[model samples]
Target: MSEDKSNRVVSGRVVSNAMDRTISVLVERRVKHPLYGKFLRRSMKLHAHDADNACNPGDWVRVEQCRPLSKTKCWRLVEIVEKAR
Candidate 1:
């Protein structure tokens, strides 16, 4: 039998709208500094697919990892967690 090995993709919200059909997602991670003992604020920008143009800034959303959608897009929006309020 073949084994399933699909990894769980991460989720984030749109942070910027500098490109067409694309949104900037701020992904946070905990990382200790070389001189510090506790974790610090670390973030990354992820390019996600927004085919419907429904995503907007300050809207909470869910994104999943997928095959490269474009030269810089590697994630797709799964759902809208919350709208800008």
Candidate 2:
């Protein structure tokens, strides 16, 4: 089988790195409210596999969809977009 390079990628901030080889990322998106038509922020917490455990809380990272590595990990860290300031 061929690996799909077009997997979905999401950019978010690392929220937690307590778990071994795993990190929690908080992805946020702005969407317009259907009724009020006002843009509102929506965020989701996703578990991602960080093989090197190099990510830290508050760091921006890009995660790509991948085969499930664990119960809650279906995404893997692609790269560290920005280091924590």
Name the top TM-score candidate. 2
Q: What lDDT does each candidate get?
A: 0.83, 0.97
Question: Candidate 2 lDDT, tens digit per residue, 1-85?
Answer: 9985789999999999999999999999999999999999999999999999999999999999999998889999999999998
Q: Each prediction's TM-score against the native? A: 0.80, 0.92
TM-score for candidate 2, residues paired by index: 0.92
Residue-level lDDT of model 1, residues 1-85, one tens digit each, is: 9998775577666898678878888877779988968889788889998888888898888888888888988888888889988
Residue 36 in candidate 1, Cα distance off native in Å: 4.3
lDDT of 2 at 21: 95
Q: Which ranges in model 1 have alpha carbons more than 4 Å from their true place?
A: 33-36
